[model samples]
Each structure stands twice: as C-alpha cells, then as structure tokens.
Target: MIRRVLACSVALVAVCSLGGCGTLPGFGDDTTEVTVWLMRNSASDDFVQRFKHGFEQEHKDVELDVRIQEWTGIGEKIDQALKDGDAPDVIEVGNTQVPRYAASGGLLDMTLESLRDWGSDAWLPGLAQPGNVDGMQYGIPWYAANRVVIYNKDLFAAAGITKPPKDRAEWLADTAKLNSGQNQGIYLAGQDWYTLAGFVWDEGGELAQEGTGDWKGALDSPAALRGMAFYKQLQALGNGPRNADEETPPQAGIFAGGKVAQMIAVPGAAKAIQKANPRLADKLGYFPIPGPTEAKPGAVFTGGSDLIIPRRTAHRAAAVRVVAALTGEKWQTDLAATMNYVPNKSTLAHAVEGQAGTAAMARGAAQGRATPNSPQWAAVEADNPIKPYMTSVLNGADPKRAAKAASDRITTLLFP
Candidate 1:
C-alpha cells in the first residue's frame, strides 16, 4: 500500500508540474490578459479588431479585452477608471488630449528605448509630436489625417478656371467666380473648429504660444485677425453653409452633385464622395491649404488618434506588445489603405499611393503643423465667447475689435 501511494503521489506531482499549477506567475502566464481602451472612431475599430484577432491567434495563451468608449465622454470615463483602479492596459487617445492626460499622470512615460526596441522611429516627426509632452514620450503615433483643399474639376472647368488656385489670392478669385446662382463659390464650415484652425494656421498665426512653463493665447494677433477677415469675406461671397453644423452634408451633397467648386476636407470624405458618385472619384483634385503670403502657404492642423498605456494597467508587457502590433508597419500599411489616412511612417506612404485623395494628404502631412501642446488648450478653445467672436469677425466685424475681445477672453482663461 505504501509503495502504491508513493507511485500515485509521484504521478500527481508530474501532472501538476506539467499543468503549471504550482508555479509563480511570470510574463506570458496563462492567466495573463491585456485590456485595451480605445475611442469608437471608424479607423480605431477596424485596427483594433484585426490587431486583437492576429495577436491572440499568434499567442494562444494570452487574451485581449477591448473596450470602445464614446469620444464625447472619454475624458470623464478615463478619469473615473483611473480613480477606481480599473483602467485599461492600453488606450487610444486623441493627439491633442495627450498633454492633458500626461500632465495629470494618467499615462505611462514610454521611453525612447522602448520605441527603438519596437522600431517605431521611422514614423514622421509630426505624427509623433502628440505623444511627446515636455520632451518626454508617453504615446505612439498610430495613424494620422490632415485637411486639404478638395475641388470638383468639373465645377472648375464650368467656372472657366483652368487650374486650382496655387495661392490665397487665386483661391479668393476662384471662389468668387464659382459663386453663382444657388451654386456657391465655396463652402466654408464656420462652426467646425478644426476647419477654423486650418484657416488660422494658414494666415501664419497660432491659437497659443509657448510661455513660461505653459502656453499663452495668441489668437488675437494681426495675422490671425487677417485670416479671420478673409474667412468673413469668403462667407459673404455666397450661400455657403451658415456654420459647420450644416456644412458637411450640404457641401458633400452639393459637391458630389457638381454644384460647389471647392472646400476644405479630410481624406475620409474622398471615399464617401466616391461612393456617392463614382464618377467624381476621377474628377476630384486635392491641394495643400494655401498660405496668406506667397512664401509660406498656410498650414493645416494635424488631427488623429494615438496609442497610450494607462498607468493603472496590470499587464504592462502584454499591453506594450499590443501597442507594438497595432502601430507596426504591417498594420499601419493595411490601415492606411482602408481608412484613407496618411501612414504614420513616411516609408509606409507608398502603401496608399493608388488610393484616391490620399497622395495629396500624405504630402500635406509632410508639411503640416500641430496645435499647441497644452492641457488647457481645449478649454480655451471651447469657450463659448470665442466662437461667436469669430462668427462676428467672419461677418465683417472690425478686425482690431474682434481680435481684442478674443485676445482678452483667451488671456483671462489662460492666466486665470
């Protein structure tokens, strides 16, 4: 009986050892899982699904949990998660929101060594700017998108314009010519903040400037005033959308129907327009936003989502691996082709060449600039007073007076 019992004990021990029943948990343990939080954007959803499936398939022992959060309530959700100690291991955050989250210690400082180890340095400088706060890296560039002047070639020809405008004056003249009965010359989406920012940067002015350990408002400068005045002049030219609220559908519908001449738009709209009217795909033309001065064409704002590691994650290594996979060349190449975004890496630009409207956007990304990296930037921008002030300026409000009021309001917000 003693000998039989010893043999049974030995067999049990072997079984347990092979099954990992008595080992201290280490990296890649069977029970280890990574949770990723992301925005519910069209691009992110596609990337996450593919990435999760591929990574989990390759690593059978590991599991991935994805949580999609609405963008409107993401900030509050992140804050709540962090407070409750239930934050995701990896997160997809807006490029502009990086500074705010980093400042609040909501994100982990991903070192340069990690980027080098993952071979992510090949991405363009502008794409990586969002992840760098105060010279420290905390996020990775997943993908990027930029605004460009999309025009209907048919409308241009009808207006007797042989070529797209190469400078601001030409754009103005062209818009005036396109402004005919019920067929507006241009479609300026005044209520869209992103579009307004493009115009602001084109005039060689910025919303904020680097100050002593923070950012100060600069929207009231002469250059910005001039830019606003130009937008107002254009708004007066025809029956364009009154604000950005009504601008997108009407402009897109009109352009696809061959009524409007040109407008500023993102790359995603290209595919939508093509789907709406297949013939317009071939008729569409893209150009960089023209600057006020001949020497410096206007710059468009860089807006896109980025990958981050929340500080509260339990599976750091797994989360890092997930981020690496999502931002890797293979995934980025595929994403750029499907989503019409500029690949984060310049080398990946070639993957999206044959796609409509992407080549011009890639060119624009190579030459675009980012908004000021400040935690308070969103607040200052969202102030109700500023938009109306801009609307007033766009409606032929005095440049100096409108600028003064905007400057004063921004100054109070920043300084206070």
Candidate 2:
C-alpha cells in the first residue's frame, strides 16, 4: 500500500454543495444516500459487495453508494472534495494521510466515537497513532500490512537450518551460512528503507523527532548509527545492488530464480513470485523479522488504509454507521480473510492465523510504527534522502559523515 500522500500544507474550508441524493440508482425519495470513496485494490469486489449488502440490509432506509478510486492524483482530488463539497460521506485514506487532511479542518474529529464505540485501545498503533492529530482522532483504521522475512524452505533445508532464527544473532549467523556458492543469503536491496526503519526502531532510534512544535532529523543519533551499522553488516551477505530499491530489479523476480534464500517483503509478494515461477510455490516460508531478543520481533513500518468522514457530509450519522460496520469484527474478519491483510485490532490477529505468511506479518504488526506525523513528512518521501544515505554507507562512505548529510537534508524538509 502507498502510505504517503502529496504534501498539502494549506488549510481548507468546506463550501456547501449537494451531497448524495435520489439521483443515485435505487435511491427512493425517503431514503438517505451515503456516498463512499474506497481506494482501488484496497478491498476485493466480494468484500465490498458483502459490506454493501449487509450494511444496506441492516439500515434499509439508507443506500450505500461505493465508488472505487485510483491512487494517482487522489490527494489532489480529495483536497478538492474536502474544500469544494462534492465530498463523499466517507473516504478511505492511507493510514499516514490523516495528519494532512485533519490539519486542513475538513475532517470530523472522531475521538469520542473512537474511544466510546471503537476499541481504540486495541487498534494497531501504526494505524491509530497517525489518525490522532493534536490528541483528536480523525481517521479510523481499516486494515494493515507490513514487511516480513520471506524465506525459501528448500534452501533452508539444504543449508542445514532446521528452523527460522529466533533473534538477530541467530539470524545473522544463519544468513552467513546460507551466503555461499551463488546463493545470496537475503537479497535485501540497499534502498529498502522501510526495512532499515525497522532496524533503526529496534535500536531505539527515530528517523526524526518532534520537540515543542519543531521537527528535526535524527538519523545521525548514536542509536541510529548503530542501526545503520547493523544494516551494512547484513546487507554484505546479499548481492543486491547498492543504488536501487527492491522494486528497481523487482526482488520477487530475483527470488523466483531459485538462488536467493530470503527477501524482506509483504506476504503478497510470494504470490507474485509464484506467478513468476510456479515450481517454488510450495517451497516458500515466512517468519517475523527477528529483533534484538527472542521474544520481540523487529519493528516494521505499517502501511494500510483508514476511513475518515468529511466534515461537510450531509449523512454524517450514516457515514459513521458505515465506518462502524466495516471496522466491526464480522466485516473485519471477512476483509482480512478475503484480502489477506492484518486486521485493524491486535485482538483480531486471528483473522489471518490460518495463513502462515499473514500470521507472521501479524506478529510483526504488533511493533509497527508510522513515519513522522508531520504533514511535511510527505515532502521528505517525495525527495527521500534515506535511500541515498543507505546506498552511500553501503558503498564504503563514512557512516557518520553520510548520516550527517542525510540528516541535514531530512531536517530541511521536516523541520518547521
């Protein structure tokens, strides 16, 4: 899932316009129509149909008009809707996008509902934290996805590894053993910054920090340097390019070639790998990215969607009902099962327990975190310095010097 939205710094005020009404098909004069905008590929047609059918069945007087949206230019389109009032009653935004929209004053503050009705306490922190802007809840988490270590079972067996490593030490040692004779141990790209973020988080280092309304890059912090050191060490076991990301060479294709033993990616990447090479379908395996200790998994950057209501929606109450219905256990279970996503709440992790890949992703989702809540964070990603920093350090640049340059760039983008 694409979690970053284009930077929208200006605040927006809603202008009234006609909301969803009788023009929609099957709309009756007495019926209330609630329009919803859901991102393309976010949910399957079956899941959407089930939700529409069940929601409308429960609220017979209400009509649910769900529109699928493409990701391209969605941020601008949403900004226009929020400002000009053609706004859908409910909109599904990326989990990290809440801060930008909420800052524009066009989203309803759902803190009360989140606390009283929704199980806010049990929601994944990665999704929930970004939704809370200045202590007010504006986004409702829908589902989550994160990266995990996807390994080749056949290669592991051949390498004499009986089970996946339990911690970083065992992981490093095992990876070293597997990094022999044309087999890249992990095939981790130098610019896989999300994976790097996990290592940084595991070392108790942050990419950036907020203090008294100002943000500063912390990539040069002592803990962060240690994280980079670890990344450099592990990256040496792979032959992945130092200048490119996983997608640049399409890591899935490399893994499908049957030489690489492991790769860090979403569980769904396995499907692509299988499509590319069917013979290895049953040879795949999954495990949470091991952390510093046995009981803890490495932290991961969570990517997913969150449902939010436009402040200008005429069907505020109905929109709330729609969100509640979708995030509820029955629909959540169906969505997770149908789409293979981690459920919104930690307690509902069982929704994907039957699938090994998704179950491993769920385990890591517990320690998931979001990028900086600052709306300017998108600007940082737009001209991401972290990627080059990783590449430079891997290419023998001084860690402190390379980190300082990257940190300086990040500060320029993120510092208010």
TM-score per prediction, in order, is 0.83, 0.93
Candidate 2 ranges with C-alpha deviation above 4 Å: 1-29
Q: Residue-wise lDDT of candidate 1 within 195-262, one digit each (tens)? A: 56667777778777777775666768877776676777766665655544335555576567767677
The per-residue C-alpha lDDT of model 1 at residue 246 equals: 32
TM-score of decoy 1: 0.83
Local accuracy of candidate 2 as per-residue lDDT tens digits, 42-113: 999988998999898899878989999999999999999999987999999999999989878999988999
Model 1 weakest lDDT span, ten residues long:
21-30
- All candidates: CA RMSD in angstroms? 4.5, 9.4
